[model samples]
Each structure stands twice: as C-alpha cells, then as structure tokens.
Target: MQIIKLNNGVEMPQLGFGVYQIPLDETEEAVYQAIKTGYRLLDTASVYGNEKETGEGIRRAIKEKLVTREELFITSKLFILQTPEEKATETIQYSLDVMGLEYLDLYLIHQPYGDIYGAWRALVKAQKNGKVRAIGISNFKSAKMIEFVGLNDVKPQINQIEINPWYQRMEDQQLHEKYDVQVEAWAPFAEGRHELFENPILSEIGLKYEKTIGQVVLRWLMQRGIVALAKSVRPERMAENINIFDFELSKEDIEKIAELDMKKSAFFDHDAPEQVEWFMQRMLETEK
Candidate 1:
C-alpha cells in the first residue's frame, strides 16, 4: 500500500509479486491469488514465457471484481534480442498483446545486453506515446547505470538489482541515490541462497518481532526505501509478504541484519561476459 515516487513522478508499490519461475499453467492462478491477497504490483517478463497466463490472472481478478486494472501495477521486461534495436517495438507489442493490456505500469530492459541503447530509446518512445507508464533496467550495476544515465535523455526511474542479507549492495545504494534512481530489489530472499532463511542474525531479529525471517527481510528493505519484489505462489505467503507494513525494524535490528552482508550475489554476476554469453544463448533459444 505504500508508494515510492520515481524520478519521473510515477508512483510504485513498495512490495510486489514476481513470476520468474512459476510454471505457465499455474502462473494465472498464482497471480490471481496474489491479487486477491492484496498485492497490487505484478512483475513478470517476456522471457518468463508466461505473460499470457499472467494476463489471464489479471483478467480473472478484474472480472471477479477482486481488483480493478487501474488498482494494479503491472511490469514486464524486454529480453535479449538478436537485433533489439529493430525488434524492440514488435517485442513490446507482443508482451502487451499476450498480457491483454494496453500499457504497462513499468517496463524494463531485462538485462543490460544487446542493443540496449536502441531498446531504451524504444522504451522512451513508448513512454511518450503511453505504451508504458515508466521505463528502467534490471541487473544493471552502478558503473553501467552511471554511464547509461549520463548518456540517455531520460534517466532510469528504477534500477532493480540483487539485494538480500547475504548479497546486499550497500555501495550501489549510494550511487543510485546520487542519481535519484529508486532501487527495486529482486530476490530479496536471495532465492534462499547462502542459507538466508537459517541465518542466526535474521532469525534473532524475527524472534523479537514475532515475525518470520522473510517478514524481517522485507521490512528491512522497505525501511531502506528499496522496492522489494518477492515471489510466492501460496496465498498465505502472499498475505504475509505484504503484511510487513504494520511493524517497524528498529535501528539496532537493522544494524544487526546489516552485519550479515556478504556484498555479492549468490547467483552468477550479471555484468560478467560469461553471463552475457549465457543470456545471449537464451535469446537464441527463445527466438528459435
């Protein structure tokens, strides 16, 4: 229910639902359940191969009057394309059609690879024409964000990156602040990487608040002003994730959780060459 204003003055929810690895057949129901559980922000991507189902979920919710289209914040991303510069518009249209929406609340460059400038320009154009509400990028680190923001006419409103107890990017947080770019955290639980859920630090904090470690982590991010994207298929978990607004993490608790910072992703590096090659291969596979 809390809103963070982007650089362009667009408002985004503090906590959101993501559909990264959710199976296609089940995505609609998961999304529908999330909406019913009071999640207004839904994050998906073209590469996730479930936009149609995600859209169907939104449609079912709207039809049942669980929530209206305007009440929800929808987001999807542009994937690595052989020639994104040329195919960007078409790809954006494909997401819109499959998602059964005229415009997206936020559209991001899934990765900083392949014709990014061209894709970003296309997104900027989409924003001007009302195809998307706001535009940004994902997996973009500080250095890339600095150069990208300096060169582009429109600055990125949100830079979603890896942020969790084990791999907290505190230094990157400072850089985003300098540019007035809001940071949205993906994998806030680190996908349970680095044994995040079992950590004594987070566990101790949770015990004091009578909350789960997941709730503690989400509350940490919310206090830091980072929009946290948490994915869950269960209705109870969805409700718990958004129920973080009631309690506040004290300064001492935050500092204790901060000690658990390992300062790097448990997953592979996003800007590394091999990672780039891996995503490029994915692009080929998807296109094929």
Candidate 2:
C-alpha cells in the first residue's frame, strides 16, 4: 500500500475503505472482509451509527490473527451536534469507547458548522493528550478553511472534500498546499455519477494500462497527491480498489483526464443557505 506522510509526520494509507452508508447490520462483515482483502485503513463517521460494528470487525480480524491492531488505521468523524467544546470532548471520548480503541489514527470535525472553532480546539487538546493522532475538517471550502486555519494555533493537518475527475477541486488543492494541509478526496468516483465507470475517456485510459475506470480514477487522484477513499461492500471490489498501487498515469493521460473537470460538486452545495438549513434540520430530527 502507498503511504503519504501528513504534516505531523504521521503516515497514512493513500487508499482507504470508507463505510459512509454501509448498513449497521452488515458493517462488521464488510469491514472484516475488507481487512481480509488487505485494507489497512477503515473510515467511518459518528453519524454513520456503526462504529461499534466496525470495531467488532477489527477485533475479529485481530483475534483471527489476520492483522494486528498496530497495523490498522481507523478514522471516525465528529458529528455536527458535537461542536461545543464540552460536547466535542465528550463525543471524542464516546467514539473511542464505542470503537473499543484507545486512540484513533485520525478524527475529523465532519462538517464545517456550529462552533467549529470550539470543536477544533477540543481536537487539538485530544491530539496533545494522545487520544488522536491527526485532526482535520471535512467538507470545508477555501474561505472557511482559511478562516479556521487563521483562528487556530495548530493549523488543520488535512482538509477532506469532494474531489474527483468531474470536480477536480484545483483551486482548493492549491489553497491547501499553501497552508501545508493535505487534501483527501471523498466521493472520488463521484458516487459513479456521469457514468464514471463507463466514461469513454477513462475507459480508453484504463485500456492502455489494462485496468478498470475506477482504478484509473483512483490512480489519477493519488498521482496528483490526493488521498483517495474508495468504498465497497463486496470483497472483490474492495480488492480491486487497492490494486491501484502498481500502475502510474502518464503526463498525457493526466492532462486528458483533467478536461473532464466540471469545477462543481456533484453533491449538495454547503455554501447555499437552504442546504445549510436542511443539514441543520436533519441533525435536529436525527437527535430526536
């Protein structure tokens, strides 16, 4: 597996298994199978409601001697409600307890809303106390990210956002670079939108290297120095996603893929007021 060194001198797998919407009942088996297939990094979030199951899977892998605890990198996010410093610290502890782990490889603020500065301060304290290895924020745009960095003493080590060939996030990438922040790509396949799996351009590029379009897309992102998280429930697909370590995309192909950039998010726009309202309402409803 290819590893990237974060600003904190911590090494993270370039590719990881994301359990975004994996069902609670199936998370354990899926995570277990992913580990069996050689996936060392597992990504889950507090809102996913399956941290315990994911931890179960990791324990199963360790008990079976498939992999040791030290060999795995586990990540979880702080939900939107867990923003105020008091709640944020409690949430961090809750996630650690639920996951049955002493420390998280990485913990992200999940979203850029509601007391982000307070939550970030909590994360910095956790890092100092050795509860988290690295801290970051997800779904934060350039302006918000810059503000967060300026307001904090310990700049965020990472800024994970929606990135793919369709939404290349070139400007965001440059901004992160300037701040010495690593960029992680979520929805790297655009959730298979725009017929990404069947795109002629990606297909043709895949044919050159005898690989699949999904693999091509992931390889392109990694080649451009972006950490790509590709998720799959099936073990075969899980294995395929990590097979990207062998090949490299050429300068010409890289340029060709760059043309597919739409410069917009395929998902909801966080900048829009209505969307922010929707997120806030959804969080309130979920709590009830």
Candidate 3:
C-alpha cells in the first residue's frame, strides 16, 4: 500500500475502505473481511452508527493476530450536530471511548456548516492532547476551506469531498495544493450514479486493462495523488477495489477519462440551502 505524506508528516494510505452506509449489524463482518483482504485503512464516522462494531472488528483482527494497531489506519468524523464549541471535546472523547481506542489516526469535521470553527478548535485540542494524529474537514468548498485555514491556528491536513469522473472538483484540488492539504475522495465511485457502469469510455479503458470500470476510475484518482475511499459490502468487491496497484493507466487513457468529467455531483449540492437543511435534519435525527 502506498502512503500520502501529510503536511504534518503523518503517512496515510492512498486507498481506504469506507463504511458510510454499511449497516451496524453487518459492519463488523464487512470490516473484518476488508482487513482480511489486506486493507489497513478503515474509514468510519460517528454518524455512521457503527463505530462500536467497526472497532470490534479491528479488535477481533488484532486478537486473532491478523494485524497490529500500528499496521491499521482508522479514521472517523465529528458529526455536524455535535458542533457546539462546548460539546466538541466530549463528543470526540465519546467517539474514542466507544471505539475503545487510545488515539485516532485522523478525525474530521464532517460538514462545512454549523459551528465548524468550534469543532475544528476541538480537533486542534484533540491533536495537542494526542487523541487524534491529524485533523481536517469534509465537504468544504474552496472559499470556506480558505477561510478556515486563515482563521485557525492549525491548518487542516486534509479535505474530504465527492470526487469522481462526473464531479472532479478540479478548482478545489488546486486550492488544496495551495494550502498543502491532501484531498480525499469520499464518493470515489460517485455511488455508481451518472450511468457510470455503462459509460463507453470507461468500458473501453477497462477492456484494455482487463479491470472493472470502478477500478479504472479509482486508479485514475489515485494516479492524480488523491486519496480514495472505496466502499463495498460484498467480499469479492472488497478484494477487487484494492487490487488496483498492479496496473497503471496510460497517459492517453488518463486524458480520455479526464475528458469524461461533467463537473457536477450526482447527489445533493453542498452549497445549496436545502442541502444544508437536509444535513442538519439528518444530524438531528441521528442525535435523537
């Protein structure tokens, strides 16, 4: 597994397993399968409602002597509803307690809205206290990201956002480079939307490499120095997602895939007010 060195000197795996929509009951099994498939990075969130089970899977792997904690990279997020400055530490600590872990490899503010500054302050404190190795934000636009960097004492180490062929966010990538922040793609496959499976360009490229369209897309993102989180509940898909290290995309293939970019998300837009309200409602529902 290749590693992306953060500005803070922390090394993160370029590819990781994400459990965004994974059911709580099945998270443990799925996470275990991912670990068994040689995936060392596990991306979960407090909002995912499966941190406990996710940690259990990690513990099970460790107990069986399959892998050590040092070999694993665990990442979780601070839910938007937990944005009150006063609640930040307690919330983060609760995440650590629930996971039964001493420290997190990375912790992120899950959204751009709410008391993000306060939440980031808490993450900064967590880092200083050794509870989190690195801190960052997700779904932040370039303007907001710049604002956060300018205001905060500790700049964000990463910015996780939706990045796939349809929603490349190239401008944000330049901003990330300017700030020395690593970019992590959350919906690296665009959740299989945008008729991604039937795209002729991707199919043609996949045929040449003898890889799936999904694998080609992921490899494209990885080749561009972006960290990709590929989620899969099926065991075979999990193995397929990580088997991308062997093949390299040719320069012509990369250009063809780049031309496929439509520059829009298949899902909700983060900048829209309705989307903000939706995010708030979901966070509130989870808190209740």
Taken over the whole model, the C-alpha lDDT of each candidate is 0.90, 0.91, 0.90
Task: Please give the TM-score that candidate 1 achieves against the real structure.
Answer: 0.97
Give the Cα error of residue 7 in candidate 3, in Å: 0.8
lDDT of 1 by residue, 143-261 (tens): 99999999998999999898988887888999999999899999999999878889888888888889999999999999999999999888888988898988999999988987888
Worst 10 residues of 3 by lDDT: 279-288
lDDT of 1 at 35: 92
Q: Tell how far residue 50 is off in model 1, in angstroms.
A: 0.5
Q: Which residue pairs of candidate 3 clash?
A: none
TM values, all candidates: 0.97, 0.98, 0.97
Give the clash count for model 3: 0
Reference-based lDDT, residue 250, model 3: 99
The residue-level lDDT of candidate 3 at 270 comes to 90
lDDT for each residue of candidate 2 in 1-288, tens digit (9 for 90 to 100): 889899999898888889989989999999999999998988998888999999999999999999998899889989788989999999999999998999999999999888898899899999999999999999999999898889889988888899988999888899999998999999999999988898999999999999999999999988989988888888889988889888899999999999999998888899899999999898998744
TM-score (C-alpha, index-matched) for candidate 3: 0.97
Write the residue-wise lDDT of candidate 3 on 136-189 in tens digits.
999998898898899888999999999999888888899899999899999888
Ordered list by TM-score, greatest first: 2, 3, 1
